[model samples]
Target: MITFYDFICPPPQATKSGNTWKTRLSLNYKGLPYKTEIIEYAEIAQLYKKNGIPPAIVFPNGYAHHTLPVIKDDITGHDVFVVDSLEIAKYLDKTYPDSPRLIPDVEDVDAQIQEFQNQLNGAVIAALPVMFKASVPHISENSQAFYKAARVRDLNFIFPDKPISSLDDLQFTPEEIHATWASLEQGFDGLSERFGGKNTFRWALGDHITYADLILAGLLLCVKAVHGEDSPQWQGFMTWSDGKWKTFLDNLGPYLSEDN
Candidate 1:
Protein backbone atom coordinates (compact mmCIF):
# COMPACT_ATOMS: atom_id res chain seq x y z
CA MET A 1 0.00 0.00 0.00
CA ILE A 2 1.08 3.55 -0.66
CA THR A 3 1.68 5.74 2.38
CA PHE A 4 0.07 9.10 1.80
CA TYR A 5 1.49 11.77 4.08
CA ASP A 6 -1.09 14.56 4.44
CA PHE A 7 -1.97 17.54 6.60
CA ILE A 8 -4.23 17.69 9.64
CA CYS A 9 -5.98 20.44 11.55
CA PRO A 10 -6.99 20.49 15.22
CA PRO A 11 -9.57 17.75 15.56
CA PRO A 12 -8.31 16.22 12.33
CA GLN A 13 -11.70 15.72 10.74
CA ALA A 14 -10.80 16.70 7.19
CA THR A 15 -7.64 17.23 5.19
CA LYS A 16 -7.84 21.04 4.83
CA SER A 17 -5.14 21.55 2.22
CA GLY A 18 -6.47 21.73 -1.35
CA ASN A 19 -3.26 20.24 -2.76
CA THR A 20 -3.56 17.32 -0.35
CA TRP A 21 -7.11 16.78 -1.49
CA LYS A 22 -5.94 16.70 -5.11
CA THR A 23 -3.52 13.90 -4.28
CA ARG A 24 -6.22 12.15 -2.29
CA LEU A 25 -8.64 12.53 -5.20
CA SER A 26 -6.27 10.78 -7.58
CA LEU A 27 -5.56 8.04 -5.06
CA ASN A 28 -9.24 7.34 -4.46
CA TYR A 29 -10.10 7.79 -8.12
CA LYS A 30 -7.68 4.97 -8.94
CA GLY A 31 -8.95 2.86 -6.04
CA LEU A 32 -5.37 2.66 -4.70
CA PRO A 33 -4.82 1.00 -1.35
CA TYR A 34 -3.05 3.84 0.41
CA LYS A 35 -2.91 4.68 4.10
CA THR A 36 -2.44 8.24 5.35
CA GLU A 37 0.10 9.74 7.73
CA ILE A 38 -1.07 13.03 9.20
CA ILE A 39 1.56 15.74 9.20
CA GLU A 40 1.18 18.95 11.16
CA TYR A 41 2.16 22.42 9.93
CA ALA A 42 5.65 22.48 11.45
CA GLU A 43 6.42 18.98 10.26
CA ILE A 44 6.45 19.72 6.52
CA ALA A 45 10.15 20.49 6.42
CA GLN A 46 10.83 17.51 8.60
CA LEU A 47 9.02 15.27 6.15
CA TYR A 48 11.26 16.45 3.33
CA LYS A 49 14.38 16.18 5.45
CA LYS A 50 13.68 12.66 6.68
CA ASN A 51 12.52 11.33 3.33
CA GLY A 52 15.69 12.81 1.74
CA ILE A 53 13.54 14.54 -0.86
CA PRO A 54 16.55 16.59 -1.85
CA PRO A 55 16.15 19.72 -3.90
CA ALA A 56 16.34 18.98 -7.61
CA ILE A 57 17.49 20.82 -10.74
CA VAL A 58 14.75 19.06 -12.67
CA PHE A 59 12.04 20.67 -14.74
CA PRO A 60 9.17 20.17 -12.26
CA ASN A 61 11.53 21.12 -9.41
CA GLY A 62 11.33 19.77 -5.86
CA TYR A 63 10.93 20.68 -2.17
CA ALA A 64 10.18 24.38 -2.27
CA HIS A 65 9.10 24.41 1.35
CA HIS A 66 5.41 24.27 2.45
CA THR A 67 5.34 20.85 0.78
CA LEU A 68 2.47 19.12 2.52
CA PRO A 69 1.42 16.15 0.43
CA VAL A 70 4.13 13.49 0.11
CA ILE A 71 3.47 9.88 -0.84
CA LYS A 72 5.53 6.74 -0.31
CA ASP A 73 4.79 3.75 -2.48
CA ASP A 74 6.44 0.59 -1.12
CA ILE A 75 4.58 -1.80 -3.39
CA THR A 76 7.30 -1.56 -6.07
CA GLY A 77 9.82 -3.31 -3.79
CA HIS A 78 11.95 -0.34 -2.75
CA ASP A 79 10.26 2.84 -1.44
CA VAL A 80 9.38 5.51 -3.96
CA PHE A 81 8.84 9.06 -2.69
CA VAL A 82 6.68 11.44 -4.65
CA VAL A 83 5.79 15.04 -3.89
CA ASP A 84 3.53 17.67 -5.45
CA SER A 85 -0.11 16.84 -6.16
CA LEU A 86 -0.14 17.10 -9.94
CA GLU A 87 2.97 14.96 -10.33
CA ILE A 88 1.53 12.45 -7.89
CA ALA A 89 -1.61 12.17 -10.01
CA LYS A 90 0.40 11.71 -13.20
CA TYR A 91 2.62 9.13 -11.53
CA LEU A 92 -0.31 7.15 -10.13
CA ASP A 93 -2.16 7.08 -13.46
CA LYS A 94 0.96 6.09 -15.36
CA THR A 95 2.01 3.40 -12.89
CA TYR A 96 -1.41 1.86 -12.46
CA PRO A 97 -2.58 1.78 -16.09
CA ASP A 98 -5.31 -0.73 -15.27
CA SER A 99 -7.09 1.77 -12.98
CA PRO A 100 -9.36 4.72 -13.83
CA ARG A 101 -7.32 7.67 -15.05
CA LEU A 102 -7.33 11.10 -13.44
CA ILE A 103 -5.61 12.63 -16.43
CA PRO A 104 -7.19 11.79 -19.78
CA ASP A 105 -5.27 10.50 -22.81
CA VAL A 106 -6.35 13.11 -25.35
CA GLU A 107 -3.92 16.02 -25.54
CA ASP A 108 -6.63 18.67 -25.96
CA VAL A 109 -8.68 17.29 -23.07
CA ASP A 110 -5.59 17.19 -20.86
CA ALA A 111 -4.90 20.80 -21.80
CA GLN A 112 -8.39 21.76 -20.71
CA ILE A 113 -7.88 20.07 -17.34
CA GLN A 114 -4.59 21.93 -16.90
CA GLU A 115 -6.33 25.22 -17.74
CA PHE A 116 -9.03 24.57 -15.14
CA GLN A 117 -6.38 23.78 -12.52
CA ASN A 118 -4.80 27.19 -13.13
CA GLN A 119 -8.18 28.89 -12.81
CA LEU A 120 -9.04 27.09 -9.60
CA ASN A 121 -5.70 28.13 -8.12
CA GLY A 122 -6.36 31.76 -9.03
CA ALA A 123 -9.80 31.63 -7.45
CA VAL A 124 -8.40 30.16 -4.26
CA ILE A 125 -5.77 32.92 -4.01
CA ALA A 126 -8.28 35.73 -4.62
CA ALA A 127 -10.52 34.31 -1.90
CA LEU A 128 -7.65 33.48 0.46
CA PRO A 129 -8.76 35.56 3.41
CA VAL A 130 -12.05 33.76 3.83
CA MET A 131 -10.30 30.38 3.69
CA PHE A 132 -7.59 31.36 6.18
CA LYS A 133 -10.03 32.94 8.64
CA ALA A 134 -12.07 29.79 8.85
CA SER A 135 -9.04 27.51 9.00
CA VAL A 136 -6.81 29.38 11.49
CA PRO A 137 -8.57 28.21 14.63
CA HIS A 138 -8.16 24.57 13.84
CA ILE A 139 -4.38 24.75 13.48
CA SER A 140 -1.83 24.33 16.23
CA GLU A 141 -1.20 27.51 18.20
CA ASN A 142 2.35 27.61 16.85
CA SER A 143 1.08 27.16 13.33
CA GLN A 144 -1.68 29.70 13.91
CA ALA A 145 0.91 32.41 14.42
CA PHE A 146 2.79 31.49 11.27
CA TYR A 147 -0.38 31.02 9.23
CA LYS A 148 -1.63 34.46 10.28
CA ALA A 149 1.65 36.12 9.35
CA ALA A 150 1.73 34.36 5.99
CA ARG A 151 -1.88 35.23 5.24
CA VAL A 152 -1.20 38.83 6.24
CA ARG A 153 1.61 38.94 3.69
CA ASP A 154 -0.68 37.49 1.00
CA LEU A 155 -3.52 39.84 1.98
CA ASN A 156 -1.17 42.79 1.86
CA PHE A 157 -0.44 42.09 -1.78
CA ILE A 158 -4.03 43.18 -2.52
CA PHE A 159 -5.27 44.84 0.66
CA PRO A 160 -2.11 46.97 1.08
CA ASP A 161 -0.68 47.95 4.50
CA LYS A 162 -3.01 47.69 7.54
CA PRO A 163 -1.86 44.12 8.03
CA ILE A 164 -4.38 41.64 9.34
CA SER A 165 -2.81 40.39 12.58
CA SER A 166 -5.62 38.06 13.48
CA LEU A 167 -8.58 36.37 11.88
CA ASP A 168 -10.95 38.33 14.15
CA ASP A 169 -9.23 41.52 13.10
CA LEU A 170 -9.68 40.77 9.41
CA GLN A 171 -12.54 42.88 8.13
CA PHE A 172 -14.17 43.07 4.72
CA THR A 173 -17.44 44.74 3.84
CA PRO A 174 -20.12 42.78 2.00
CA GLU A 175 -19.22 44.67 -1.15
CA GLU A 176 -15.57 43.86 -0.69
CA ILE A 177 -16.32 40.18 -0.29
CA HIS A 178 -18.44 40.33 -3.44
CA ALA A 179 -15.57 41.92 -5.31
CA THR A 180 -13.20 39.14 -4.23
CA TRP A 181 -15.69 36.55 -5.38
CA ALA A 182 -15.96 38.47 -8.63
CA SER A 183 -12.24 38.00 -9.11
CA LEU A 184 -12.70 34.30 -8.35
CA GLU A 185 -15.41 34.13 -11.00
CA GLN A 186 -12.90 35.17 -13.62
CA GLY A 187 -10.99 32.00 -12.76
CA PHE A 188 -13.97 29.99 -14.04
CA ASP A 189 -13.93 31.53 -17.52
CA GLY A 190 -15.31 28.82 -19.83
CA LEU A 191 -16.67 26.68 -17.01
CA SER A 192 -20.09 28.27 -16.56
CA GLU A 193 -20.89 28.14 -20.27
CA ARG A 194 -21.42 24.39 -20.20
CA PHE A 195 -24.57 24.45 -18.08
CA GLY A 196 -26.60 27.13 -19.86
CA GLY A 197 -25.19 30.59 -20.60
CA LYS A 198 -23.75 32.39 -17.59
CA ASN A 199 -22.27 30.83 -14.44
CA THR A 200 -23.34 27.25 -15.12
CA PHE A 201 -21.02 24.30 -15.50
CA ARG A 202 -22.38 20.88 -14.65
CA TRP A 203 -18.87 19.45 -14.52
CA ALA A 204 -15.33 20.55 -15.30
CA LEU A 205 -15.71 18.39 -18.40
CA GLY A 206 -19.36 17.54 -18.85
CA ASP A 207 -20.24 14.42 -16.77
CA HIS A 208 -16.65 13.22 -16.34
CA ILE A 209 -14.54 13.24 -13.18
CA THR A 210 -11.29 14.44 -14.63
CA TYR A 211 -8.32 16.06 -12.91
CA ALA A 212 -10.02 19.38 -13.54
CA ASP A 213 -12.99 18.21 -11.53
CA LEU A 214 -10.75 17.14 -8.67
CA ILE A 215 -8.89 20.45 -8.70
CA LEU A 216 -12.05 22.57 -8.88
CA ALA A 217 -13.66 20.55 -6.10
CA GLY A 218 -10.50 20.95 -4.02
CA LEU A 219 -10.74 24.75 -4.28
CA LEU A 220 -14.33 24.80 -2.99
CA LEU A 221 -13.43 22.22 -0.36
CA CYS A 222 -10.92 24.70 1.10
CA VAL A 223 -13.77 27.16 1.56
CA LYS A 224 -16.05 24.41 2.87
CA ALA A 225 -13.37 23.45 5.39
CA VAL A 226 -13.55 26.94 6.81
CA HIS A 227 -17.35 27.07 7.18
CA GLY A 228 -18.68 23.50 7.07
CA GLU A 229 -21.09 21.96 4.47
CA ASP A 230 -23.83 24.61 4.34
CA SER A 231 -21.63 27.59 4.99
CA PRO A 232 -22.99 31.11 4.77
CA GLN A 233 -20.14 31.81 2.36
CA TRP A 234 -21.69 29.40 -0.13
CA GLN A 235 -25.15 30.92 0.38
CA GLY A 236 -23.81 34.43 -0.02
CA PHE A 237 -21.96 33.46 -3.18
CA MET A 238 -25.11 31.86 -4.60
CA THR A 239 -27.12 34.98 -3.79
CA TRP A 240 -24.54 37.20 -5.44
CA SER A 241 -24.40 35.16 -8.64
CA ASP A 242 -27.98 33.95 -9.12
CA GLY A 243 -27.26 30.59 -7.46
CA LYS A 244 -24.61 29.67 -9.98
CA TRP A 245 -21.81 28.88 -7.54
CA LYS A 246 -24.18 26.96 -5.28
CA THR A 247 -25.37 24.86 -8.20
CA PHE A 248 -21.78 24.08 -9.13
CA LEU A 249 -21.02 23.02 -5.56
CA ASP A 250 -24.20 20.94 -5.39
CA ASN A 251 -23.27 19.18 -8.61
CA LEU A 252 -19.97 18.11 -7.03
CA GLY A 253 -21.72 16.33 -4.17
CA PRO A 254 -20.52 12.85 -5.14
CA TYR A 255 -16.77 13.60 -5.34
CA LEU A 256 -16.50 14.86 -1.76
CA SER A 257 -13.71 12.72 -0.29
CA GLU A 258 -12.96 14.27 3.14
CA ASP A 259 -9.78 12.66 4.50
CA ASN A 260 -6.35 12.70 2.95
Candidate 2:
Protein backbone atom coordinates (compact mmCIF):
# COMPACT_ATOMS: atom_id res chain seq x y z
CA MET A 1 0.00 0.00 0.00
CA ILE A 2 1.00 3.56 -0.58
CA THR A 3 0.03 6.59 1.45
CA PHE A 4 -0.13 9.60 -0.85
CA TYR A 5 -0.07 12.98 0.83
CA ASP A 6 -2.08 15.80 -0.78
CA PHE A 7 -3.21 19.21 0.38
CA ILE A 8 -6.77 19.82 1.46
CA CYS A 9 -9.26 22.41 0.23
CA PRO A 10 -12.93 22.98 1.07
CA PRO A 11 -15.72 21.18 -0.67
CA PRO A 12 -16.49 22.04 -4.30
CA GLN A 13 -12.76 22.43 -4.88
CA ALA A 14 -11.09 19.55 -3.14
CA THR A 15 -7.68 18.52 -4.48
CA LYS A 16 -6.64 21.70 -6.29
CA SER A 17 -2.86 21.44 -6.25
CA GLY A 18 -1.36 20.66 -9.64
CA ASN A 19 1.88 19.39 -8.15
CA THR A 20 0.03 16.78 -6.12
CA TRP A 21 -2.19 15.89 -9.02
CA LYS A 22 0.88 14.94 -11.00
CA THR A 23 1.67 12.20 -8.51
CA ARG A 24 -1.95 11.07 -8.34
CA LEU A 25 -2.07 10.74 -12.10
CA SER A 26 1.20 8.88 -12.14
CA LEU A 27 0.04 6.43 -9.48
CA ASN A 28 -3.19 5.76 -11.29
CA TYR A 29 -1.40 5.37 -14.58
CA LYS A 30 0.80 2.66 -13.07
CA GLY A 31 -2.19 0.94 -11.46
CA LEU A 32 -0.79 1.52 -8.04
CA PRO A 33 -3.10 1.09 -5.05
CA TYR A 34 -2.93 4.07 -2.76
CA LYS A 35 -5.00 6.16 -0.36
CA THR A 36 -4.77 9.91 0.03
CA GLU A 37 -3.77 11.64 3.26
CA ILE A 38 -5.00 15.20 2.90
CA ILE A 39 -3.05 17.77 4.89
CA GLU A 40 -3.81 21.39 5.47
CA TYR A 41 -1.50 24.04 4.05
CA ALA A 42 0.03 24.97 7.39
CA GLU A 43 0.50 21.38 8.60
CA ILE A 44 2.75 20.12 5.81
CA ALA A 45 6.09 20.77 7.41
CA GLN A 46 5.02 19.54 10.84
CA LEU A 47 3.60 16.29 9.50
CA TYR A 48 6.64 15.63 7.34
CA LYS A 49 8.95 16.16 10.27
CA LYS A 50 6.96 13.84 12.48
CA ASN A 51 7.08 11.10 9.86
CA GLY A 52 10.83 11.53 9.26
CA ILE A 53 10.18 12.68 5.71
CA PRO A 54 12.59 15.37 4.60
CA PRO A 55 11.56 18.64 3.09
CA ALA A 56 11.28 18.89 -0.65
CA ILE A 57 13.53 21.93 -0.85
CA VAL A 58 15.53 24.17 1.41
CA PHE A 59 16.31 27.83 0.93
CA PRO A 60 19.53 29.70 1.59
CA ASN A 61 17.80 31.23 4.64
CA GLY A 62 17.63 27.66 6.05
CA TYR A 63 13.87 27.43 5.80
CA ALA A 64 12.91 23.90 4.78
CA HIS A 65 10.00 23.88 2.39
CA HIS A 66 7.99 20.73 2.87
CA THR A 67 5.36 20.06 0.22
CA LEU A 68 2.71 17.50 -0.68
CA PRO A 69 2.71 14.91 -3.48
CA VAL A 70 4.79 12.82 -1.09
CA ILE A 71 4.27 9.09 -0.93
CA LYS A 72 5.03 6.60 1.86
CA ASP A 73 5.48 3.26 0.25
CA ASP A 74 4.85 0.13 2.33
CA ILE A 75 4.98 -2.28 -0.57
CA THR A 76 8.75 -2.27 -0.39
CA GLY A 77 8.62 -3.92 3.10
CA HIS A 78 9.74 -0.72 4.75
CA ASP A 79 8.52 2.85 5.03
CA VAL A 80 10.06 4.66 2.10
CA PHE A 81 8.91 8.24 1.73
CA VAL A 82 9.40 9.90 -1.63
CA VAL A 83 8.99 13.65 -1.83
CA ASP A 84 8.04 15.71 -4.89
CA SER A 85 5.91 14.49 -7.78
CA LEU A 86 8.77 13.89 -10.20
CA GLU A 87 10.77 12.00 -7.62
CA ILE A 88 7.75 9.93 -6.65
CA ALA A 89 7.15 8.97 -10.28
CA LYS A 90 10.76 7.99 -10.72
CA TYR A 91 10.68 6.02 -7.50
CA LEU A 92 7.56 4.16 -8.53
CA ASP A 93 9.03 3.31 -11.90
CA LYS A 94 12.28 2.09 -10.36
CA THR A 95 10.54 -0.01 -7.72
CA TYR A 96 7.87 -1.44 -9.99
CA PRO A 97 9.68 -2.15 -13.21
CA ASP A 98 6.83 -4.28 -14.53
CA SER A 99 4.46 -1.31 -14.66
CA PRO A 100 4.44 1.09 -17.58
CA ARG A 101 7.19 3.65 -17.20
CA LEU A 102 6.16 7.25 -16.68
CA ILE A 103 9.70 8.49 -17.14
CA PRO A 104 10.86 6.78 -20.32
CA ASP A 105 13.83 4.43 -20.12
CA VAL A 106 15.35 5.84 -23.33
CA GLU A 107 18.62 7.66 -23.03
CA ASP A 108 18.12 11.44 -22.65
CA VAL A 109 14.33 11.00 -22.72
CA ASP A 110 13.90 12.12 -19.13
CA ALA A 111 16.03 15.20 -19.69
CA GLN A 112 14.08 16.08 -22.82
CA ILE A 113 10.79 15.69 -20.96
CA GLN A 114 12.03 17.86 -18.12
CA GLU A 115 12.98 20.60 -20.59
CA PHE A 116 9.58 20.38 -22.20
CA GLN A 117 7.89 20.68 -18.79
CA ASN A 118 9.98 23.72 -17.98
CA GLN A 119 8.95 25.53 -21.14
CA LEU A 120 5.32 24.45 -20.68
CA ASN A 121 5.31 25.80 -17.13
CA GLY A 122 6.58 29.16 -18.37
CA ALA A 123 3.39 29.46 -20.39
CA VAL A 124 1.30 28.81 -17.28
CA ILE A 125 2.64 31.85 -15.45
CA ALA A 126 0.36 34.29 -17.26
CA ALA A 127 -2.70 32.55 -15.89
CA LEU A 128 -1.55 32.40 -12.28
CA PRO A 129 -3.21 35.59 -11.07
CA VAL A 130 -6.64 34.55 -12.21
CA MET A 131 -6.22 31.00 -10.95
CA PHE A 132 -5.05 32.17 -7.55
CA LYS A 133 -7.96 34.57 -7.25
CA ALA A 134 -10.44 31.82 -8.03
CA SER A 135 -8.92 29.57 -5.38
CA VAL A 136 -9.14 32.02 -2.47
CA PRO A 137 -12.69 31.31 -1.41
CA HIS A 138 -12.14 27.59 -1.30
CA ILE A 139 -9.17 27.69 1.04
CA SER A 140 -9.56 27.63 4.80
CA GLU A 141 -9.05 30.87 6.70
CA ASN A 142 -5.97 29.51 8.44
CA SER A 143 -4.45 28.24 5.23
CA GLN A 144 -5.36 31.50 3.57
CA ALA A 145 -3.49 33.42 6.23
CA PHE A 146 -0.53 31.08 5.94
CA TYR A 147 -0.40 31.43 2.14
CA LYS A 148 -0.76 35.22 2.32
CA ALA A 149 2.18 35.48 4.66
CA ALA A 150 4.25 33.04 2.61
CA ARG A 151 3.52 34.97 -0.57
CA VAL A 152 4.59 38.23 1.00
CA ARG A 153 7.76 36.68 2.35
CA ASP A 154 8.80 34.46 -0.58
CA LEU A 155 6.80 35.51 -3.63
CA ASN A 156 6.50 39.27 -3.41
CA PHE A 157 8.17 39.47 -6.80
CA ILE A 158 5.18 37.82 -8.46
CA PHE A 159 3.73 41.28 -9.02
CA PRO A 160 6.71 43.58 -9.34
CA ASP A 161 4.74 46.42 -10.85
CA LYS A 162 2.64 46.65 -7.70
CA PRO A 163 2.96 45.70 -4.07
CA ILE A 164 1.21 42.52 -2.97
CA SER A 165 0.88 42.62 0.79
CA SER A 166 -2.24 40.51 0.77
CA LEU A 167 -3.74 37.81 -1.41
CA ASP A 168 -6.35 40.26 -2.65
CA ASP A 169 -3.56 42.37 -4.10
CA LEU A 170 -2.85 39.63 -6.60
CA GLN A 171 -5.93 40.57 -8.58
CA PHE A 172 -5.64 42.01 -12.09
CA THR A 173 -7.85 44.18 -14.23
CA PRO A 174 -10.46 42.55 -16.50
CA GLU A 175 -8.45 43.46 -19.59
CA GLU A 176 -5.30 41.99 -18.09
CA ILE A 177 -7.11 38.81 -17.21
CA HIS A 178 -8.35 38.35 -20.76
CA ALA A 179 -4.89 38.96 -22.14
CA THR A 180 -3.44 36.45 -19.72
CA TRP A 181 -5.85 33.77 -20.85
CA ALA A 182 -5.11 34.58 -24.48
CA SER A 183 -1.40 34.27 -23.82
CA LEU A 184 -1.92 30.88 -22.17
CA GLU A 185 -3.96 29.71 -25.16
CA GLN A 186 -1.17 30.76 -27.48
CA GLY A 187 1.27 28.83 -25.33
CA PHE A 188 -0.81 25.69 -25.69
CA ASP A 189 -0.98 26.23 -29.42
CA GLY A 190 2.78 26.50 -29.62
CA LEU A 191 3.19 23.31 -27.59
CA SER A 192 0.83 21.47 -29.92
CA GLU A 193 2.72 22.70 -32.98
CA ARG A 194 5.95 21.44 -31.51
CA PHE A 195 4.49 17.95 -31.18
CA GLY A 196 3.15 17.82 -34.77
CA GLY A 197 0.27 20.28 -34.74
CA LYS A 198 -2.92 20.51 -32.68
CA ASN A 199 -4.71 17.24 -31.98
CA THR A 200 -2.21 15.30 -34.07
CA PHE A 201 -0.70 13.38 -31.16
CA ARG A 202 -2.59 11.63 -28.40
CA TRP A 203 0.24 11.90 -25.90
CA ALA A 204 3.32 14.07 -25.46
CA LEU A 205 5.59 11.44 -26.99
CA GLY A 206 3.41 10.10 -29.75
CA ASP A 207 1.02 7.29 -28.71
CA HIS A 208 2.61 6.29 -25.40
CA ILE A 209 1.96 8.45 -22.35
CA THR A 210 4.89 9.84 -20.42
CA TYR A 211 5.71 12.22 -17.59
CA ALA A 212 5.32 15.10 -20.03
CA ASP A 213 1.67 14.29 -20.57
CA LEU A 214 1.06 14.01 -16.82
CA ILE A 215 2.75 17.37 -16.27
CA LEU A 216 0.37 19.08 -18.68
CA ALA A 217 -2.67 17.17 -17.44
CA GLY A 218 -1.87 18.04 -13.85
CA LEU A 219 -2.08 21.77 -14.63
CA LEU A 220 -5.29 21.36 -16.58
CA LEU A 221 -6.86 19.26 -13.83
CA CYS A 222 -5.94 21.86 -11.25
CA VAL A 223 -7.74 24.48 -13.30
CA LYS A 224 -10.75 22.26 -13.73
CA ALA A 225 -10.84 21.34 -10.04
CA VAL A 226 -10.41 24.86 -8.71
CA HIS A 227 -12.59 26.72 -11.23
CA GLY A 228 -15.21 23.99 -11.57
CA GLU A 229 -16.11 22.38 -14.86
CA ASP A 230 -19.05 24.75 -15.36
CA SER A 231 -17.07 27.96 -14.89
CA PRO A 232 -16.14 30.11 -17.85
CA GLN A 233 -12.47 29.67 -17.00
CA TRP A 234 -12.73 25.93 -17.55
CA GLN A 235 -15.19 26.23 -20.44
CA GLY A 236 -12.89 28.62 -22.28
CA PHE A 237 -9.91 26.40 -21.58
CA MET A 238 -11.71 23.37 -23.01
CA THR A 239 -12.28 25.21 -26.29
CA TRP A 240 -8.84 26.73 -26.52
CA SER A 241 -6.67 25.98 -29.57
CA ASP A 242 -9.45 24.20 -31.41
CA GLY A 243 -10.16 21.93 -28.42
CA LYS A 244 -6.73 20.37 -28.42
CA TRP A 245 -6.45 20.48 -24.64
CA LYS A 246 -9.89 18.99 -24.21
CA THR A 247 -8.98 16.08 -26.45
CA PHE A 248 -5.70 15.59 -24.68
CA LEU A 249 -7.29 15.47 -21.24
CA ASP A 250 -10.07 13.22 -22.43
CA ASN A 251 -7.52 10.70 -23.59
CA LEU A 252 -6.20 10.66 -20.04
CA GLY A 253 -9.64 10.12 -18.49
CA PRO A 254 -8.96 6.59 -17.26
CA TYR A 255 -6.11 7.80 -15.10
CA LEU A 256 -8.00 10.82 -13.73
CA SER A 257 -9.70 8.98 -10.89
CA GLU A 258 -9.45 10.36 -7.35
CA ASP A 259 -9.30 7.14 -5.37
CA ASN A 260 -9.40 8.82 -2.02
Q: Tell me, by lDDT, which candidate is best.
A: 2
What tens-digit string does per-residue lDDT give for candidate 1 at 139-194?
77767776676566557655675566556787778898778767765655434554
Best-matching candidate per TM-score: 2
Q: Give per-residue CA lDDT, model 2, range 47-154, as digits (tens).
A: 888988777888888978877778898885988888988888889999999999998878888778878887897787667667777767777777988756665554
* Cα lDDT computed for each candidate against the true fold: 0.69, 0.81
Q: How close is candidate 2 to the true structure, as a TM-score?
A: 0.92
Q: Which stretches of candidate 2 lie over 4 Å from their true place?
A: 152-154, 157-163
Which 10-residue window in model 2 sums to the lowest lDDT? 150-159
Separate clash counts for every candidate: 1, 0
Query: What TM-score do all the candidates reach, one by one?
Result: 0.77, 0.92
The clash number for model 1 is 1
